[model samples]
Target: MTDHTINKAVLRRLLSYALDDPKKLGYAILLLLVASLADVSGPWLIQHFIDHYIARDQYPLDMVAGLALAYVALMLTAAWFRYKQSLQFNQIAISVVQRVRKQLFERMINQPLSAFDYMPTGKLVSRITNDTESIKDFYVFVIGTVLKNVVLIAVMLVVMCLLSPRLAAVVAVLLPVVMAIMVIYQRKSADAYRTMRDLLADINASMSESIQGMSLIQLMRQEQAFSQQFSVLTRRHLASQIGVMKLNGLLLRPLIDFLSGVALLSLVALFGVSGTELIGVGVLYAFISYLGRVTEPLIELTQQLSLLQQAMVASERIFGFIDARQQAYGDDTRPLASGQLACRNVSFSYDGQQSVLDGIDVELPHRGFLALVGHTGSGKSTLASLMMGFYPLTEGELTLDGRPLASLAQSVLREGIAMVQQDPHVLSDTVRENVRLGRAVSDDDIWQALEKVGLAGQIRLYDAGLDTRLGSGEANLSAGQKQLLALARVLVARPKILILDEATANIDSGTEHQIQQALQILRQDMSIVVIAHRLSTIIEADEILVLSRGQIIERGNHPQLLTQQGHYWQMYQLQQAGEHLHKLEESAGVPEAS
Candidate 1:
């Protein structure tokens, strides 16, 4: 995006945050206003002390003491007000950052599956954590401190002009030029820093990917190679940081030199051009002292401008995500009356160019079981996803009972369907709580489901039983045990339509048998759509559909397909032949005619 576009977007979103908590903004502005007035009073009080109390032996003890007291009082008041300002502005800063992060998080979750396929998890995380932090710095420092400087400069300039117009005119002339230089520097610095920010996000993405794949790295003996790749990213990150520092160094030094020159020249002219009597020594001293104070705000404004630029970069990334379209969840949802589902002339493709499921037609009557067998890439999972309405079909209609899939609201469809994927996710919580998964299932029901999956005895052996905590990813549970827990969770859900997308493929024989028993119980009350790899598992299925290369090549019962002597029969005979040979070898090994 263009720099102008980036700034405008950031400013718009930042203002929205300010508007969100107007009370904090109002309080911060009020405190700064009070503090600025106190800041402007300092030089006048010092001038009074020098001229009235210290000159010509005219010291009045009571007046001197009172002035000293007033000076201390103003100093204390300014400090108190500054503390209040920090507290109020800090709250505003935190709230705005949190609001932006929350919006970005929600948008990420609700995006279409296609969008997620393209963006990595780590990059999204950087936007929420690192990018939002930049915006927070701008709010607390730039907005809170910079505006106070504007007020202090205005009051000081007016007082200086009243004291001596010629001196004021010289300062006024140099002030705008100094400001113009700072503005140019700010624009350049902003662009450089934004590039640096994006590079840092890329580095984060690479690190996260490497950490998640650490096991594969070890198994392949790629530790050295992976470390080299990581070092490359680290160097790129260091270079970006150095670039930002270099940009600041170039701009800041020149701006400071110009301001310093202005101050020096103004002092020389005041001493040389003004008649000694016209400007008292005390007055001259005050003007010189206040000049130093005035430049402080100018310096602060320029430095804060750099931070504002960084925030602008961060905000663009944040809002770029938040402004994306949220997945459309329609208002109307009609629940399925009988759970009879169909896919009519359906076609789909992940990448639009190649179709995964082509012109397919299929149906499952209520409470019926349909087993699907296919070669590695033969559209089984795609068909299951289409049935769930997670992806819109490229060509044809998917319906539940008599209603179009589009007519059924996504929320309604999700509520009615439950799926057990090959790899199930387990959170860091107790076993019972993980299985409940935010639903309210009774303890009795949970135990009954576990017994059905042959896990009741295992639960009884643990000291905490159902209350025992499982680590994240269920690291505490064995792989087979985790799969059984997944089955039990799904069994308790009792969804009208159960989809097993290779659910039993990742478990041992014992767990697989338990899953079979659970599937048997499920068949009585719910329609089951299973994607299977081992043909023997589906031998007794109501009907089997065999697919190849995104198209169904055969469909029939076990006996009918074997009689046809096609692909299924050939595969079965090969397995039988291997088993018979194994049996003959075992028999020959025994003592002959013992």
Candidate 2:
């Protein structure tokens, strides 16, 4: 929504963040009011000195000195209050922003996996950091400065009306025109600010994407292409910012100055035509001073209005993200009895156009091992994700231990099941921490888990063993090492059920052998579902499902599937042929042409 139609609920919520610490806010308000009063007293004191002391020729040395001293004291008092007001206002604003950022981060992390599929990580980061920072300006500058200016304007108007009602009427007439300008500015700037925010998000997304794929870009020799793409986004962002700057420059201070000049000229003409008796010198001087003070606040308010508009746009985006419906699961605290998983006539579609998995029926008893073999786009990974509670089923039902999976609590599902992906992320932490994953696990358990994955000996060779620090993407480890590390992580969890989605696809034969051995130990007690592209790995599975275009074309043990001479048999024969060709070339000592 635009700033003009700022949702009351959102504004109220934003205000509530500041009001959370009412004492600090109250102290800031009090200081602001005192500072404004002190500011207003300046014109009154000047008028008093002009009318009673200077104009009346009653300048006594001691009296003049005391008046000057009192004026200086008032100025110093105003400065002190203004300084304290700034500190308190900043404190309140910063606190509110901190709370908002924390809540946004918490909400983001708790979001379902599906949300990350569409939302850009960089854009999310921008909303948490940049957008919230804009809201900080709303609290620190807009709210505090606007309130103080309003008070100052009110006091000045009251004194102006008392001094000369006619001049006050002129100001009143011009006030609406100034407000009209502010309204126009707000409307025009709102769109500009929103554009700027969107462009910034785009830039962040582009930069993050580039950084993440830097290695790929370099490998492909496409650095220049990526640079151009990033440059385009940055240029667009810069252009958006320039548009906002131009709008602010034309509308904010310049318009206020023009309006102030008009008011001053009007005052001069009124006084010129009228005599001293009608508008005294002291009154004229005070009116001129009050007019300047009035316009200063108007200028500040106009500038803050721009910031407020930006903040409103940011709040809308943030609130939109916060308002997304989280995935629904039961709050049942009961532990899962067994990991027996079953899917009955489960049909699924990502976009509701074409089905990815159709009329699928499968069951795995506790401690059983089922392997899903499929070509790419055969819905093998999708089925595994469904089993992990990553997405809601589109049709039919998936269950665990005779209970509907959807009805099970997320914690229960997590406790009972774990999945190791094809390309698992290795956290930038010590090996122990990575495996423990913040759980209260002992070093012995960590070592045992590593040993199970055949990584203990390799880890022990490092200077710090399990305590060695790993870089992001596990730069210190090979693809097989990272995969083994991920396996170690799951082993430590000791899940009742495990799904490995091509977990050994990239590992060497030796590392694959190590993983297969670990799986043998795991399958003794836990139900294992393995999604594999490699046919050799699943030869020993109790049952293997050959998925073709989302349907199971063949379901049997390796020998049974081979006897059928179906899709599974053809795939196995082709893979064996490809391996034999590679071995023949290696034995002949021939370097195959790229």
Candidate 3:
């Protein structure tokens, strides 16, 4: 769509948010009109006092002082209106901004996992915090400054026309000039503001990446390299900001003020030429005062144009996020009760043309243990993702029990299947909370699952037991312990199907043995599908599929695959040799007793 169309759509959305609380908005509008009317009446009171009393040489102190007191009363009323209207406008802006933030947050979480493969978390965070803040500023400026100033201008113009048509005409010249400046400023600065926001997100992204990888950067001594890269992003961001600053500096308040000066000069020159016969001295005073007051709105408006551009750009990003397509799901809400899985002629691709997994078929046994072992990019992880409905299959019939896997509701799918990755994210929360993960699992169940994973004894030694918050290094669970905690989490979840994607790849032998024992017990009640790099981890699987180049090259139980002396047999032999060599190195490195 064209930028104009997009801007209109964003404005309409913002207006809707603003209008959500119509009662308050209406009250604010009423008060703005009251404030504007009262403020504009002051000039007329002065004009009356000068023209009717002072100019006529009939100075009655009672009447003049009465007019003065009335002017004060009007000013006081206007001040009160200003306060109430500003409060109402502020409340409305805050509500709209709050709604916008919440909607943006919902949009971020509603996206499918696949959407996040290309989306950066840092940019998303920038949208939620920085961009939303820009939107808030825009709302406040538009309502409190621009809107009220506009009402004041309208009242002033109407009063000016009543007093002197020619002076009002002189002031009208500034409106078109102000409008032109606004149009040009918006046109020139939209892209600059958008680019600035993008660069800010990039800076945030770079900083987030550096923070997450700080240890890796220090270990590799790439601190200087990372610093250089970060400096480049920040410099680009700074340049973008300076460009926006220049645009605002050039096209905003100063230019508008210059135009206002020209308008005021034209008004004064017109009054000078007309003289006392055509323009009364009192009329001249009111016109000059109104011109001065009018400049405030014009300058205020031009200043707000910059914020308008920013809000338009930021809102476009926010709406784009809110409008992105949601992940497809189906109407099946009945919870999946069985672990039986069937895959027939399954095929997949990331970019449509290149197949990642092709013509795969599987019939998992009831309460079975199935293993998929392959080298990198051999589609093991892809198949595991499919098992959990993480991606749509290119061509396949994948079923959980008797129902199509894709036809199940998200709740049904999540409740029925559990996936454990190699690196499980451990929350810096209590062990009980981490294990339960907001599930309704009890403390007793948490301890039981911990015991099954061989972590119960260690946890029991802690003063607070399950309530103890996990931490780093010697203060908390190591990587393997975290992996075990994740397993315990799964046990409490009680999913019908458990998919392990190298869940034990990094742990030591003793922990691996403990996990194997846990899996053996879990296999009785849950169907387990494992993708293992270590062939030894899944030697006793009911079936093993050795995948190569997006296709299964060999399939059987470990002993049967060994007898075949095929791809699976060769992989096992290689792993055995590597293990034997590592053991020899360890023995050779042992020091003699001295």
Best by lDDT: 2
By the lDDT metric, which is better: model 1 or model 2? 2
lDDT string for model 3 (89-171, tens) is 77887887788889888877867777788777788888888888888887778657877988899999999999989888888
lDDT string for model 1 (408-473, tens) is 777777767777777777779988997889888999999998898777888888788888888854
Cα misplacement distance, residue 551 of candidate 3 (Å): 1.1
- Scored by CA lDDT, what does every candidate get? 0.78, 0.87, 0.86
- After superposition, the stretches of candidate 2 with alpha carbons farther than 4 Å from their true spots are 2-5, 472-475, 590-594
Task: For model 1, give the 10-residue run with minimal summed lDDT.
Answer: 1-10
* TM-score, cand. 1 vs. native: 0.92
Estimate the TM-score of every prediction.
0.92, 0.96, 0.94
Name the better of 2 and 3 by lDDT: 2
* Index of the highest-TM-score prediction: 2
List candidate 1 stretches off by more than 4 Å.
4-6, 472-475, 569-594
Candidate 2's TM-score reads 0.96
Per-residue lDDT tens digits for candidate 2, residues 246-265, read: 98899888887988899899
